[model samples]
Target: MNWDDLRVFLAVARAEGLSGAAKTLRLDPATAGRRIARLERSLGAVLFAKSPQGYALTEAGQRLLPRAEAAEAALAEGRAETAGAGGERLSGTLRIGAPDGCANYLLPQVCAQIGAAHPDLDIQILALPRVVNLSRREADLAITVSPPATQRLRAEKLSDYHLSLAASRDWLAAHGAPDGPEALKGARMIGYIPDMIFDAELDYLAGFGVTRVPLASNAVSVQLNLARAGAGLAIVHDFALPAAPDLVRVLPDRVRLTRAFWLVSHAGPRDARLDRFATLLRDGMRAEIARLEASVA
Candidate 1:
């Protein structure tokens, strides 16, 4: 089988649609579709079952997946072995998926500094409100609030960060600060939508007796904006506090919570370029979180 055709097949399988696979491979949608058709003809077997929802792999495709992945890994290993043969800087795209809060507040500076040092490297950050699917190739790397439970992926703890109840100075002036959790009664709370909380780690208000959140958003940035606009008190990441200078922590001692960030990626052969980049990213996150939190403190 043509390796290029297999590569296209792998991309389609991961993306689950021609358009998405085309985007990832930098090919036109028509071209991607034609390639898949050609591959099926050559193999004399159907690879995918098409539906309005998306492409679903056929039994043939399922059987072919492992062999294709092995070939892909071998090619990746070869590339890694020859990477930077002449002291060349890291080039090509590195896409990271992260929760919107971390994506909005943490990654820009860290990625900017990395891009500055390696001018050829292109970085893409997907500020998704849900868990990034590594199996779907949604991102080359993902920064998650909790470690993935799947054994197919590898995860490393980056840093532990804090969150505290905060409200706009204007809101506090009007409503008065809550002395404790019990004092939160009758307060207009801002937080994630109850049923839309995707991860257990994101259910920040669970133990605080906050049964209702009148102002809610799945995206942390939006919640922060609501708090900044004096809508109500919300739990804000300590590293994100500097972005809203008008906001002040309420019940800091009693209502504070701690969480850690995990760097997650597909388990595979080590690539020197990715290793170096991961190191820089990990250290940058530690420093940035410390700096931002200290400024708020």
Candidate 2:
């Protein structure tokens, strides 16, 4: 229950014997034994079964060992990030993943800025729609809309952005723009193929009466390209829409859609580098959204 008890338990579990644990803990062998006994007594469990070679942890001690070590590790991280530890330079690899739109927009900017600020830190970026697996260490940080439920991971809502359907003026002139969701029933839609990254966007659009006419390009870039060329309407995030001048918004009133992107990381001491990068991203995105609204206005 006490920190000392846990520390003593960890010392013995790691050291393999009371004598070795005593040396590690800077205490006498009998004192180490006494502490272990008291720890076991407090919990009403046997900590170790003695042998000629060393002490072997009982099932209970084996179970307790990992938890105690994790607690210690977490505690150390907490101390490192505390008030007195100001300007603790982060020098470690931080793996991160986010959706492709982010990669296209601000992923590089954020990474470059953070990398410049913290010269010793290395960053790896993976951009995809599917949530990265924190349990498998696929990423140390993630930006996604996925709900966070992993045991040792943390997640928070990062920011929100809007989705828009765009089509070239000529495309609209030929096919005529849909006045309502029902009108979309006959219009050609540039849908992502079944297994592509933006398939979920197509699924969302299907509810709006926009049936899939499947464009030849399976990639989002190609879909946007075709949309710009007056091929068909493509659903795209507001962040990536402005680059194409020819593409105009299609039935904004009928398109009832908004999505929140979340930022996730392994739960522990607050990562200052990640924290700084998140603030930069959040502010930049807010500015971008405001600019988008102003342009529409």
Candidate 3:
């Protein structure tokens, strides 16, 4: 039950092998093996079963893994808290995972300002089409269209943006805009590919009583671009349309929908770097949310 031995055990559990764990811990393979053995002996359990494939965790290891990882995170949190007490420049990578539309349209300005403020810190934005797994430490922070329902995670409304059905003026002139909600069923609709709809919120058309989308894509940008190209009518965020003068909202009053972006983080110990960045992000978003809502209004 030595803390050092537990650290070695945790590393091996993650790396799944002695050599990889040794590489990670910067310990010789022999020493790493000895640490694991010591931990196993102290705990009186066969923690891992070695095989040709790798070291697979036994029941004891499986049970201890989460506790050990939690301990590691707690230790890191202590270090981050200590560092936060001093007024030193933060120098580490902060990874943020966000959906495509928000990542593309909202993040550039926010990230630019953040970069200017924290030149020593590297910000990595992973613009993904799907939700990131915060439980597995996939990202330091995530902006999700839907609030996370998972335990040990904190989620707050980042901003509420307006969505509406839109099409290029050229397309509207060519095919004609739908006169009513009933007519929209036959309109040439561009939307997310049915199976690729990661979040239920992205299923904008279904609520409008439209079942068929003739042209579709997994990416929001592609759908927006397709609408801009006069291919079809699309459900798009109002904030993304301001620059594209050709696209016009089809049903200004009737078809409007509002969705909020939720900022989510693991409910682990707080870090000054994360706290500062979150505050910056939150404040910037508060200033922009009104403009975004007004654009549609």
Best by lDDT: 1
Q: What lDDT tens digits, residue by residue, belong to model 3 across residues 235-294?
A: 888888875778999878888887878789988888877977786665555445444545
**Candidate 3 versus the native: TM-score?**
0.68
Number of backbone clashes in candidate 1 = 0
* Regions of model 3 farther than 4 Å from truth: 1-89, 292-296
* Candidate 3, residue 141: how far the Cα is off, in Å: 0.1
Residues 184-211, model 2: lDDT tens digits: 6676777566555443533655676654
Error of 1 at 295 (Å): 0.7
lDDT of each: 0.84, 0.68, 0.79
How many backbone clashes can be found in candidate 2? 0
TM-score list, all predictions: 0.70, 0.60, 0.68
Candidate 1 vs candidate 3: which has greater TM-score? 1
* lDDT for model 1: 0.84
lDDT of 2 at 104: 67
Candidate 1 per-residue lDDT over residues 1-297, each given as its tens digit = 899899789778766789867865679989999999999999999999999988989999999976776675455445444444545678899999999999999999888877766779999999999999989999988999988889898777666688999999999999999878886656789999999998999888877777889999998999999999999999999999998999999988898897888888888887787877786677677667766886876
Residue 251, model 3, lDDT: 76
RMSD of 3: 15.7
